[model samples]
Target: MSDTFFAYLVTLAYGDKETPTLAQVVFLSENEAEDTRTVARALLQNAKQTAPEKTRFDWSTLKVHGSQSLSDDELMGLVAAAAQGQVGVGRVSTLKLS
Candidate 1:
């Protein structure tokens, strides 16, 4: 059986005045996802407190499966190739949330 990994596409937004930042974080299991979310929330809260304008910080998470369980280097290379291939991908970042 192939190893599977969970990837969470986290979209962070600070009010409606600015565009949301997109990030992908990959984890090995549900427990890791929980831990990662806790850290993410704390960081966002701090950001909300220090913003120039007072705006509520919100984030949405989308969970996906990496069926092939690609390594971090492999994933980075793939994203780079996609960007170079005129795929319209600005920048793809994958966070290692082990």
Candidate 2:
């Protein structure tokens, strides 16, 4: 999908970090999408690199917005509380656009 066709805004915070990292994934805009994906992957890797030997962080699919133009605060909420877990993507949202 094109980044313009599908854009994602993700706000993530480390478990202990005071501030968070915000990334925008744009499928149409390969560059931006690649950038965000890279950051996400890097962050995931960083967390894994620091994780204790017997622990693991589950991979999850998070949605912070729809095709239109709005942000998913719920997804951000989950990310804010990011534990050694993943987001429940099964909850397909039909949320109203803002």
| Per-model RMSD to reference | 14.5, 13.0
CA deviation > 4 Å runs, candidate 2: 1-10, 13-34, 50-98
lDDT score for candidate 1 against the true structure: 0.33
The numbered model that scores best in TM-score is 2
For model 2 the local lDDT of residue 95 reads: 21
- TM-score list, all predictions: 0.22, 0.22
State the lDDT of candidate 2 residue by residue for 23-58, as single tens digits.
222112223333434445534443446533322222
Cα-based lDDT at residue 98, candidate 1: 62
Question: Where is model 2 poorest over a 10-residue stretch in terms of lDDT?
Answer: 87-96
Query: What overall lDDT goes with each candidate model?
Result: 0.33, 0.34
